[model samples]
Target: MNQAIANLASEADRAEALQLQLEAGETIVELDPKVIHGSFVKDRLDGFTDPKFIELREGLKTSEQIIPVLVRPHPDIKGEYQLAFGHRRVEALRQLGRKVKAIVRNLSDEDLILAQGKENTDRADLSFIEKALFALRLDQQGVRRQVIMDALTITSKGVLSGMISLASSLPTELIEAIGSAPSIGRPRWETFAQLLADPSHESTWRELIRQEQFHALSSDARFERTLKSVAVRKEKVSDEQIIKTGEGRKIATAQSSKRAVKLTIPTKHTGEFAQFLLRKLPDIYEEFAASAANTTSDNE
Candidate 1:
């Protein structure tokens, strides 16, 4: 009878604490990890083999999840919940087949996204490209630009524009293939985007990413390899050739590469040569065009 009275007292104390929590706009609850679905917009590219995730899983094996995940009652499914944040914790708990401690709230779609993005920003764990892609996904989903900027903590319109542009320029498949390259920054990603501007180069990346060897590499290494694979190798410039008059007096020196020829004329002759080259360019281009047409005809 004394044990039963103690149990009743404990239950009453718990109820009072829960009421306080509700009044403070939060109610902590234990939920089956299986019933909590991930946020609609993904903000991470962490796989099972990811070192951080592995570490989290291993840590959870021994310690309790002190931080509670934020969740909302499932809008569509009765008796289930949708996660707002703490995806890693929920996933770890799910893998361990343990209950998830969560803070339940009533949140609208925008509210959920705001909470999700805020948590990630506070943690400062999402990579540059991951944040960009998340913004892009929110944009694609018709979320207001202001909301996206607020969610990402972006203050400048130009910054937001660049993020969306970078995300839009790359093929989604390629981004997924590369995963989140944490060490790679904006400049390298922009360079990679420029390299892939030629559609033919994308196929090279596609084929390379399909290979088992590429998949074996780490995310950052995969990005490096992919960038190297599609990068245009600059052709070696040929040795300089001397140009001379009929008397063999050197007038200029010319160096040629696959794309261009640079002629270095003495400064004294600059004006005269510039005028002369301008005068002769039309005839030279006509001859070149005729020769190109003949080569094409012969090949056909």
Candidate 2:
């Protein structure tokens, strides 16, 4: 994108540009959102949590759906359509209970892929993982690499093949389990994919991902949690050391391992200090107990 052109373009112009990359070059039209089904195969991110998506929804609430989405008449479903691009618009209108404005062309399966990929590419909208997943979907349909490259504007077939392979390595259940981790990029996903290749990590991966706390996390955090769990490189040895002072000191030692922890006050430094500790244990124990309960609750 030229800086000057981008700088001068209004929001409406951007929306039109974002949406109007129809592969069939069809005329735009107004249609009801309820009548349009999503792609036959899922090619886009699932959950609509992106801030831009939310903004689009809020914008639709206040204004008419000006930017027309690209849609094709559904082959199987009479009087229905399939979206090539503009899923965000479709989703927003669906949530708002509003009719969609679309360009209804009878696009071929391959054309639909092209149109969808092109529109997202023009907008730079798809995350690296999202693009990888979309590539995997296109490949599953037996779409040619040249077509995929042209659609996604990738010059390298090797990169495209790698993306599909990486995406295919992980189960669909696991992808949905993780949601769309938009904040995670290629390197992290590649690392996570490599970790998934090990059979021994499966149980640990399932355990980490299945936790309620995992679901409670942001998309990025969810990805991070999975990556950290089974990778031995991330395996940490927790510290255990005692601080000492000649007579008495405020210093204490907290010893921790992977599974257990202990806090100690050195008896060598202050003889008979155990009695003082005992006397203060009630207050200290209360605080510790409260903290432990909070940690447990957070984990749960």
Best by lDDT: 1
lDDT per residue for candidate 2 within 45-161, as digits (tens), equals 556875768888998899987678888889898998999988889989999988888878779988998888887787765777778888888888888889889888999988988
Collision count of model 2: 0
- lDDT value, candidate 1, whole model: 0.85
- Candidate 1 per-residue lDDT, tens place, 224-254, comes to 9988777633224565789989997888889
Q: Backbone clashes per model, in order?
A: 0, 0
Runs in model 1 deviating more than 4 A are 1-25, 232-300
TM-score per candidate? 0.71, 0.70
TM-score, predicted candidate 1 vs. hidden true structure = 0.71
Off by over 4 Å in 2: 1-27, 232-300
